[model samples]
Target: MDSRSVSSRLRELVKFLGTVQGDLSNVTGPPSLLAPSSVVEVGHAWAQRPAVFAAPALESDPEKRSLLVLRWFLTSLRSQLYVNGAPGVSIKKPLNAFLGELFFASWTDEEHKATTQLVAEQVSHHPPITAMHIADREHGIRADGYARVEMTFNGAVNIRQVGHAMVHIDRYDEDHLVPLPDVKIRGFLGGCMYPEITGTYQIMSSAGFVTEIYFSGEGMISGKRNSFQARIYRREDTKRREPLYEATGIWSKGWTVKDVRTGDVLEVYDVEAPENAPMPIDIAPLDEQDEWESRRAWAGVLAGMASGDMRIVLAEKTKIEQAQRQLRAQEAAEGRKWEPLLFRSQEGEDHAVFHELTEGTGWRLFNERTKGVWKVDESKVVGAQSPYRGELTPLG
Candidate 1:
């Protein structure tokens, strides 16, 4: 589509999205440019490559294990931004997730003989935050994190992620803190909107290794899009002149890692390689899924969007929002507060592992920003059910 037509379409979309509940004011335009999936599904996209996520568990050496973790993070970044960065397919606003909404998926890693499970929930609605937990019990790898987009319009749409994730490997007793990056969705007014992530982010581990990654697309670094450079060095080194390993390339395609001392190739990760393909995620059939489940709850809205029926999309979306409002009102009238079913707010040293890992680093929990430092409350997950007192809240 040309810029003129795209501009008109974007204006209409922005007007409609502005009326939606929660923080959706800064979404870029055009229905055709929008993702058919909801935000909860988008949250699960980061961990789509399950084999890469489980790779670190297979490495026994501390240095190799650290590099594997960095590889997993880079691979996941490609999965998360591939749609927005791809040609023809560009930046599209996803449906905002409603509070209490749940998403569940799992994939089996044949090589590891392990099942990796993912659970994500819309823990907050006003500021719009999604908390996710992924665990491979057999491999003893667990990652817990929350995210929300903070958007701004300055010619182009600038999006900043407002949370952090921590991954813990049980075998090594290591904790790795992963930080998010800043992204810009450009070319929107001219019709073909695309995303570019530009900034520096890091992965700090308790094992005393820090992987500093810099994303400098186009003019800043190379003339290519999605270009990045990463260095893995000891935490004590402030200057970081001598790194143990170095990685450089475009994340959308692939990157190469080299041993700094030996000047030998270490690993090459290609995004389009058959081995890097995302494993199929499995979920229960819609008929058998709980009313609170994301797929079941958003069935009507998703179907509407897929069929290009805006009427159905608006009606179904409004119905869910209204029910949530009424539920909140009832709780307020009874002088009670709504609590998350699968997660709990963490305060102080409740998450001692995370605190210890992030001690010297500039990173912080940002509890106030996310409403609370949300962590999985395993006790509540047993025989999981809706937290609502009476019947499940009717959605869709």
Candidate 2:
């Protein structure tokens, strides 16, 4: 593009950004100098000012990794700034999301507080945020090998569009996050790798054998694992959501989805339990620094990133199954053995272990063996393999 065209576009883009800023979701009421000041001040305190990523740096031979580093910096900068610029005094985003159902150490809500009266209930009710930064890269496509790419998902169809990942490194100011043993973010997003899978359905009715409502879409998400299969289905005259549940291996537990008009849970085909329960990761809790209210933030980013990927894999497992079926058809024509997702390969008679993982099996591993047979849901065993994929991890 010519310089004149470029300048014209920049002018237009800037105006568009300003217009959208006036109306965005979860946004602070209005723009005030003071509102942004708090966020900017804290943001500036960080060791380095975030550099907005540019394609030049990302695609450049000498600065590819640097571009990624800058990518993290810029995205983290926005979240930090936004949190610090949250609506009330002390520019921090409210602690409510992080607190869940537990009464905060300095909780302001009386009814919201968790008294010593109900410990077990509180524990079951609250699950940590896992990841907090709003500018999450996990939901987007990975900048694979510095290819310098940007991907989008409609999330109206395939939930496998969600991706699971571990933000091996997370640094947004002094509150540095360097997992001692390394941590992975685990969660899900309504993103996708393919948009063709995104499909929406209307609640016309479900009164007979055709009592099923399915809306499929694709999304690119990261939490637990990278990518997922997004599915919103109505089964037995009920609507239940399993975003990225088909092809991906991750499963969302105890999540409640309610209709906006009249809070009703969708009862799609019941998603069964899995074989293994997720292994617990050691988590450090808030202490003295927490009560100080000095930017009361919880680092659940890692957990969400880890689990999101797990969910993505589970969703993607559906695709894997379809591919396997195709492979089987060919094999049958040629007379060969079909490779099941969670089958075993043995080098010798005494050494036999599980091999591939079906989509359901992947869900078992992602959820860490929570659903499967009697105690486990049979659906989870539909297909599965071992849960070990040589993923690249971060260094200490």
Instruction: Please name the candidate that would achieve the greatest TM-score relative to the true structure.
Output: 1
Model 2: lowest-lDDT 10 consecutive positions: 116-125
- Winner by lDDT: 1
Q: In candidate 1, what residue range of length 10 has the lowest lDDT sum?
A: 22-31
| lDDT for residue 79 in candidate 2, whole number 0-100 | 31
lDDT of 1 by residue, 1-396 (tens): 676667777776556545555334333334455566667766556566666777788787777777988887887776576554464555677766777888888887676576778888878776778888988888889898887677766556677788778888988888888887878876555466667888888888888888989987755354777789998888888574479999999887899999998999988878888877777889999988878888888888879888988778778777887887787788789997767768877774576766776776666766677776788877666667644324756441
Clashing pairs in 1: none
Per-residue lDDT over 1-396 for candidate 2, one digit per residue giving the tens place of the 0 to 100 score: 465644554454334335542212112222211121211112121111112212212232322222233223322222333333221112212222111111111101122221111000011101111111111132221110000011122211111211111122223111111110111211112111111212221211111111111222223562332112222232232344322111222222222233333445432211222321111211225443222111222223223324545344334333333443464467569896432111122232221111111111221111211111101112322432212111310100
Over 4 Å off, model 1: 1-8, 11-33, 83-87, 220-222, 348-350, 385-390, 394-396
TM-score, candidate number 1:
0.89
